[model samples]
Target: MAVTANKIELMQIADAVAREKSIDRMIVIEAMEDALSRAARSRYGAETNVRAEIDPQTGETRLWRLMEVVETVENDSAEIALVDAQRQNPEAELGDFLSDPLPPVDFGRVAALAAKQTITQKVRDAERENQYEEFKDRQGEIISGLIKRIEYGHVIVDLGRAEAVIRRDQQIPREPLRQGDRVRAYVADVRREPRGPQIFLSRTHPQFVARLFEQEVPEVYDGVIEIKAVARDPGSRAKIGVYSNDSSIDPVGACVGMRGSRVQAVVSEIAGERIDIVPWSEDTATFIVNALAPAEVAKVVLDEEMERVEVVVAEDQLSLAIGRRGQNVRLASQLSGYEIDLMTEEEEAKKRQKEYAERSALFMEVLDVDEMIANLLVAEGFARVEEIAYVDLDEIAMIEGFDDETAQELQARAQEWLENERQALDAKRREMGVEDDLLTIEGLDLKMVVALAEEGVKTVEDLAGCVTDDLTGWTERVEGEKKHYEGMLEKYRVRPETAEAMIAEARARVGWDVEEEPAEA
Candidate 1:
């Protein structure tokens, strides 16, 4: 075959190939270098003394044979007679090697074949790397791609270089996908294998809300705003916390865009999934209020030590605040970093009334009382301890098992328990080493504590007035001890407000420091 051996012209071929394959020319040059080396191996297969070189800049090929000088030519490929060697090198002697450049063997067919194969391999490898790098960091991100095919409810999305699998479980319920239809999905995972790289996709992740934001809001990509947290129940509703680094820029506004354009774009992608964008706040109560947006909240009482929030909403907003199946409140709790308990004004009032009744009561053991006595109490509309404590002994004797002595004993035991609880609470308060203030802590559920706080004992000083006998109701043995209550108060990390409420109530009953604080001047 007719061949052209122009070094400059071959460099042009490297550039052309690099451009066509969207690859570096250096890669083409490297491939060509490797190819020519292989060709040299083929050309001088029997010639151990042969070596080859090519000009990387110009793609020129050259071959040289390192022939040994000998008195006689024993091996034609490796050795030449000293006389012949002297013709090439005048100072050549026996046992000395000589550099003899071989006339250019036409690498026309070999170089062309090698260059073609090498370039093809290099381009394929580059494409594989590019695809891997593109999808690796995109895990958990939402992307829309054409559905290339569907196999038994599993979808294959054409994500440019490769297809990602959307397993059946990860698909939205009843969302139909057809080939050539564009589908929006979450990039659940990316994995590399011997075959190639696999990108696993989904339609059911809560982060899909955030992912949709990334696609719709350019501010997120440009770093003008950031998403702090996301809580979602997919296909229903979601809450996302957003904050702006630039004070002038409202992160929520940026995400929402003009007339809800940005958020609308995301919502459209998710088939109208509702998203609530809230301003992120370090104050947990404020955050919770915002997370439960579109639901009017009247008050948020935070139990900081317990990481809980009591949210008060209007009677009309209770169902809205809680949402269907408690989803809104649940997501708000997660997003705001507080365990939320929602209540309406009416519910709160009822709850307070019940608590007040329990508070004013004397100690009574329902487990110890006979069914006949309990029925009598119920018939007399005295289902609560407060009524039982104040009930007259003459009224109690009207029932079956009560003698005068038993009635007196039951009444006295209730009074003693009530009194003892007050003293123990006062002692705990003094041990707390504080005065003029009370701690309202949560997570203290001891029956004894409840009894003591009901006695209007406000301070630890009042708690010192009671003994173990006061805390023990009619029961013979208390399951938990005083030290156990103390340990729970410390371990459960009751908020200062709850502890204060408990102390104030206790002190009021004990009649110690009865003077109310004067109004602020």
Candidate 2:
């Protein structure tokens, strides 16, 4: 069957709209059918059940006045007597519809305008849907577009089909955007709203640096080299931890390219931001050491349980390690996923002496010892009285000038002092209305229970539900400044592993199933 010239023109219009909107041709044709149906309904009784269909192959249009077969016909427009419906189809049951084919509807002025608006709105909706589906999965991608305009510091980029906006905060600070300038950015997110899909772009995201490296360095894009971590002070400085799966390949050299070519390309893209491609390591200590590049690390003290590190450097290198306004160390901390504290060698020495003096004083007061004896104990690595009480006698006896008898006497004194302290703490705990069942947890002692009471954790269930951070606390970096927060047992020296075990033990004691740690992928 041949299509008429008018039918071919209708198909051509659907094809054109579909191509222009980047939507399916069938969607455009369906929208057209809906527009025509609405126009027909305006001419016919609005309540009448009118239906329209357009053949996809020939653009053949059909219209029908559908009336339901009923025993009693109260509405003549929408209902027909069952006997009269059987004249059209013998199988027309009470629930079925009898179709009466009507002539093609000639659109009047008002109806034509309404139909045009309906089609335009539907096509616009389809276009927005297409845009969302196209860019939703393209997040974290590098996209280039012309800077269309800037509205109150937000740079709007026309991404060919859809528009994306780089919020002021997401843009690199001090980098001005000009209209018609070509800009590349990371597709941060895509959100669907009633109007259209909101495409968010970012120039300051750490991944933007990683992506730049990906494009500049073949090794980075390939599986040979993997960029493990990235941290950026956006357009000022950045540090990335890269690792190589192949033992022969050096990740840092690969990312740097020949004669700084690869790294320089990335730096130029982000407004001359300095890039530090540190080699990633399985050892957290070694990785953090590399992260703080351009400064020699004199010493490193890692508190793995606390996820913090004390990096002591020479006085001359301290300023360089910390960088201008503490940018270097801040990026290092963020890249390494550890709270870092930088100290000069002399400062660290002074810090050590202060701690030793404090520990000596604490021992002298607690165990009824003289300053000389307490200082000796502190020198022997007895930071807490509990450590002296619980340590093996042989280890204490091995100390210079400390015989077996002396070790036994010192241990006895330590244990006696701890018992008295525990009694005082237990009394405080009872006075504070802490539950007695809290003592049933194996690792928790009387002092720890009192500390828990102070922090409002007073029951077995409370301890059971606690996370590692809940008991041991956590540290976070804000504006390049390290903020320290004390946990319930921060003074008692509770390790993260110990906290988790104690929580599990408490849960088991309270008849709750102790959960197992998840297996690594």
Candidate 3:
């Protein structure tokens, strides 16, 4: 009776552990079997190979020592000679594993403690693995849980099945969240570490606002309206760029809802953060204008090479456009994916006047012309000496008060100046020890060669090692600010395609595989 009861209790313990840890029952049984095997080995002899098994249905325990059938026994503890093995089983062959059954082990206090520890460690490991698997694929999702505790400015959330953390930086600034409060957050990341699975949650994530809109707006959730982009100041303000596939639907109106109910619902969830739903446009300039809502943009000048925009507003609108500490323009930049330079109309006028004067001066110096003729060239938008040297003579002739003979004279002077400049640049390039082969690149000229050598790209192989971004710069978001890294040819306004083709040609000349990649659509 006692032995039968003991076996039933063992099975019951395995079942209880599986349910408590939310693990597979078979896993718990396997862990228990391993624990028993370890305990049996301690008693039998450490060198003896032992295994344990429990019958799932009856909870009957079985322990055995494994021995190999060998032609010549090397160690009698683990091997049996073929003739000796055949005596136990007629079918036994050399190299076959034979089991030697032993009487059940009596659990001594020390052995029992070791067995318990092993079972516990195994169960805990399995539980951690299960937790990691559960949350690994749940990243970028919205989850709600009760705030269980606050540790060193981090919020520990009880997600019912597992614990997740919203680190200090992930929380909205000055947003009051207390213990026992139910909060929703974006699942920023999930990592499996030695301690366990760590699920990172964020309330201040820009996508968190989008997810909230998805919950509040039916049209957005159903895909009739799409959120094109989002930028948040977190707990203070946000902008959402929305688009509608259906022509009849107003995406911004839909997101705003009846009497502002939908937006208010989202606002309440995110600690009453103000949201501006701007209609998205395929035209970047139109989109940027829309993103800077309530602040009228009198003019927008886009620099496609740098992905930057200059926005000119009225003087009275400047403060509103810039917001407190430049927040409005900053968020607009983030939302539109363009760096914004906001200024008043007066400031823009002053800048234009300064540019006109500079251009006139440049023409006067390079073409050896008087102020009136230089001003005429500047007014005709001839900003560079290269334009005068290379542009069609008809463009200069077409300028008012300029005859074809005068246009021809200007072109001659411009060409002479450019050739002289090119010679000087070439002298500098040679002095810098730049390889002459670098000048052989189809798109690179003497000026570019000098620039490349100045930047330490002195050889054909050096140019071949370059990526397109090295010659035509790139813009990226760093800590929520748009940062522009000037490229080598950025002053020349070199297109990425031009830079890439030059690099590809250089690489091909240097014996690299330069298979042309199809342009992205």
The RMSD (Cα, Å) of candidate 3 is: 7.3
The model with the greatest lDDT is: 3
List the candidate numbers ranked by lDDT, top first: 3, 2, 1
Off by over 4 Å in 3: 1-3, 67-99, 353-521
TM-score of each: 0.49, 0.75, 0.75
Say which prediction, candidate 1 or candidate 3, comes out ahead on TM-score: 3
RMSD values, in order shown: 20.2, 7.3, 7.3
Candidate 1 achieves a global lDDT of: 0.71
lDDT of 3 at 263: 97
- lDDT of model 3 at position 58: 85
lDDT of 1 by residue, 345-439 (tens): 88887976675445434122532555455455555555455455567988766666667877776666666665676677667655544353334
Candidate 3, residues 66-108: lDDT per residue as tens digits? 9999988878778889998899999998889999898997979
Q: Count clashes in each candidate, considering only residues at least 3 apart in sequence or on different chains.
A: 30, 0, 0
Q: Model 2 Cα displacement at 30 (Å)?
A: 1.4
